[model samples]
Target: MPTDASNFSVTMVIRSILYTTQQASESPYNYVPTEWVCIFFLTAYSISTAIHMGQALRYKLWWMIPTVTFAGILEIFGWSCRLWSSQSPELLRPFEMQLFGTILAPTPLVAAYFIIFGRITIHFGPQFSRLTPNMYIIVFFSLDTICLTIQAVGSVFAAEAVNEYKSPTLGGNIMLGGISAQLFAIWVYLGLAAEFFLRRKYNAPFRRQVIKFGKGQRSMSKDVQCMIYALGFCTICIIIRSVYRTVELADGWSGTVISTESYFNWLDGGFVVVAMYTLNVIHPGIYLKSVDTSLPDEDKVNLSYVF
Candidate 1:
């Protein structure tokens, strides 16, 4: 009887220890366990985005290829970090993974946005608007860069604080705010781009005529429609992620955020990643003029013969 009692006591102690460790490791802010779910979605997203990016490269869509590639890589890395966190939630390194991923991933999306805006201006004729295509790219991307820089700096600061004091500090808040501002900028930019496209489409009699041609017109409209859809979807995904992040960090690591890991997974990993991969399915290259035939006949023949 004494032997059985001793074994039971030992088992209880071990279980208690495990439970305490788990509780300690859990994010104080979250109410649900979602690390595994986040990892799964992010991993899937990364793979899909990578595949699409490869397709973009295959078509020589130079501007978009790099952006998609960057986003894919960052997402994979970020998810890997999340996975690591799930394994050992007490470790601070996982936070660094998330920080880098969050900071770098959005840059490509911003770049993609710039390209779309530039294309719209060119399509409509730059003279029709006060802003030049190049100016739009320069101004918006510059602002994006600034926001990224601030978020990065804030993340680094937060990491440093965590490492030194074993707690998150004001840096996290700063980073959160920076990301929120970026989200705002993205929405504003999207609104402007949508307005520009609508106005331009409305004014273009040739495009309007082409649309009235029925089945054949579908091919002509596909590219423009895809571009608009991709941009709008990306903007919405980013905005949702940003809002979640703001809420997550609102308490500045004091643990007020609910469903942290799961929310990040669904909003950031799943949605953003899926939206990015969608770009590959409807790549602008499919609609843009063929690169091989861009040159004059003489040049094309010479180039083909040389190859």
Candidate 2:
């Protein structure tokens, strides 16, 4: 039903969009991604995921089945997409796959950490915690899910804008806001967790258990200490990664931080690798095995707290 002039105008608009992609100056990533690096991460994630699955099954840690295992799978998929993108830098599909996979992968890992903290709260004694074990899981998990949704929605808008040759400012701001919120949430969680320990340290009325170690001391088990340490370490790693991501996103897609593979390799991918491997070495399932077995079925510290 369009006249010839209208059809010509439509053609011109399409041509303009197409022309943007063909420009040498334009690329989703400013530089071609390194193939070997992508493969390395993919292989590492594959191994880590395999180990997590085996540990979860052997320990019957059904709660972790959905959290840690799922997170590793996401990392694998994301790196695989990165590997594909290295081969075809011009393709948007692979870039998007990697972008989303990497962005959302950490969410489950963070959730798993939250669940573990809840269990720790129970193991020590619910009396020391300001929030109930169930509430800890519920409140933080909800915050994490909300943050993830915001990032995802923002990514979709940004991608669409890129495809249309439009400025991605609005979408980028949304993403920045989401990641920033996530960073703030992590800090708050750390604060609460630290407060829990401090309460036990000072509040004599609430101090039911004292963890002692080293010099012929008799108190909390070694594995429990290790588990707590591992949780803290993994959390630190997540914080580092989160901070880096916030900065990278803030700089925008064309920003130097996003353009350089080295920064991402070390700050983003490197931190995640360390966290995942650290979990493998000090797995909650193995370390917390005694807690699970010692507690009565009804009193077990697991995801049943969710319901």
- Say which candidate scores most in TM-score: 2
In Å, residue 111's CA in model 1 sits off its true spot by 1.8
- The lDDT of each candidate is 0.64, 0.80
lDDT of 2: 0.80
Give lDDT tens digits, candidate 2, residues 198-241.
Answer: 77666532333242212322134789889989999999998999
List runs of model 2 lying over 4 Å from the truth.
Answer: 1-26, 204-219, 295-307
TM-score of 2: 0.83
- Model 1, span 183-299: residue lDDT tens: 777777776666665555565321222112122211224556667677677777777777777777775575645345555656666677667766666566665544223334553
Task: Give the least accurate 10-residue stretch of model 2, judged by summed lDDT.
Answer: 209-218
Error of 1 at 295 (Å): 12
